[model samples]
Target: MVLTRSASRAAKCIFKWLPNEILHLVATELAPTDLAVLCRASRLLKNIASPLLYYSVELSTSSSLISFARSICQSVDASLPNSARLLEVAKFTDKKPPISPRIVKEINDALCRLIRLEVLILLQRSIDYTYLLEHGQFPQLVVFQYLVPSHALPALTSFLNRHKNITDLGFISPDSLKFSTPLSLPNLQSFMGSFAFLSTLDLTDVSLTHLTLLLYPPDIAVSHAVLVNLHEMKMLSTVEVMGMHANERAILHVIAGHLPHVQELVFHHFTSTSSPISPNESVNIAASLETLGELRSIDFGGVGGNVIEDRHMVAQWSAACKSLTSVILDERQWDFKENDWVVSWNL
Candidate 1:
């Protein structure tokens, strides 16, 4: 059924008169495209909805990046209060080529005007962001994710040192192994990066609560260093180990000693045959778990049946930790209810 022009106008008028809180609630549910269209209804609506529309800006092509940068630069009041809080710069594989130098310059210039930007995600590896980092463009950044090359590590380190307010950081720096110094991040609570980077961090002053480590094999020394660093972080409550290799029983022991306060643990073990863990190694893992008295939840994957089904392993793990609240094996989960483990295999 199509509405008459008068009826549409009446409905819009009614919507415009709704309470500000209700309107904001409604706006939160709208997609970015819908929110942009809604901003055209009235000046009041535009003022109320522009922030939501521009909260997260993703430029997937050089054209969009250059166009948006030009548009924002042309505006007399480029430093708008409702500037985008999150900005993502990346080239789509199926779309245009990588961002050109001119587009990169525009993006940096636009970032300077985004005074309230909180998160900056850079997936473009070729772009030089040293200028943006040196300039106080993203003064309010709390979360930063970047793909760093070896040459850019020094600049990235400098940026991280200056941004003490950053609470979450994710990096993919395969070439860079160590920083010049232990850059202090007093407010950092979550970190996601390679095991090499994690091992090099001096987190003595940082109170990290969540950590995600990307593991690699044949790096026993690096794994030991990572565990040593984890031992210093007494506030950690959650830990995730991805690409976990076999024969890391000693590493598991170190984890139990270091992350005593960790309540949740997830392990995505490597299934390659080259680093197969023995039954003895599984026993060591069970022994390590017994030491983690505060552990309430644990998830395991890709580890052999010897570790998962061993009677001593399960019995000791279940007996030593009275706080066992949830256990996830393979794709199934078990929750403790009435002092008995209840399976939820379907989930």
Candidate 2:
């Protein structure tokens, strides 16, 4: 299936006439290796692929990080703004001493040149990036995820306050910020962090509308505290509870009590149990759902129980909540059978 020289020339001629938009679309689907090769094909291909090639980069080694920083500094020297929009560093060892101050400075300098950077993810344990915030770098950043030490909280809070554009944030080790007063993020719309950290936050002034809590069968008192604090967020409309725990009923009641306006709910329970839902728990859950007048969707994952026997229970819930449009239990969807008013599960 080898092409002759004339045939190859004809193919190139046809491809050369393709629209730039089509070429950009095709380039986006190419693997990094393929993209590198494509960039060498012609000036137009190189121009189209350059931005995509450098758009999002992950560095896993100190040498690679240093090299990338040097390259970005070179781009700055040439008066060219970096094309990077997302940058991730995944290999910082938490137990080891921090990266050399010199390297950190160099990395900071490189990051400053990225005028369009919108997301930065530091998968390491703790790395101080206060310099970026202090210098007003990443002015367009809208999402940020990082793990930092307790001493970094002030700088982090300052950063959040300065960057009013940030709407989504994840603090992998939120314990660091627990002792500090809740930092107001008027524009923050979604938050992902530990249940303990989220429970203690004073979100009275924040505009949080979505919350994702990572839980591990939190202490009853802690869970109660979280729910009480969450009640203050009157605008919250979506909640996701994810963890391997057996307190589903308690969690659901808390959510229903605190976030009455929640329109979407997702439960990812990884705990395995053969026990069926207790009658009291079912009653409580139904009562809570009844209070969630705006509830529309519920997505359940890793849920196991007597689903067949509980069909009637689900039906009662559907009947009570006229606004409910869809209910997903594990991998099955429950639809109300109009003929008998029974809930039927479908794949």
Writing each residue's lDDT as its tens digit, candidate 1 over 9-126 gives 3465766456667777888899988887887987666666777877888877667667767767776544443368988887454456566787778767777677788988887776
TM-score of 1: 0.79
Q: Score candidate 1 by lDDT.
A: 0.70
Error of model 2, residue 129, in angstroms: 4.3
Q: Model 1 — which ten-residue stretch has the worst lDDT?
A: 1-10
In model 2, how large is the Cα lDDT of residue 128?
Answer: 55
User: Candidate 1, which segments miss by more than 4 Å at Cα?
Assistant: 1-25, 40-44, 58-67, 89-93, 244-250, 269-281, 302-316
TM-score for each candidate, following the candidate numbering: 0.79, 0.74
lDDT of 2 by residue, 239-263 (tens): 8876656565467877777678888
Q: Which candidate ranks first by TM-score, i.e. highest?
A: 1
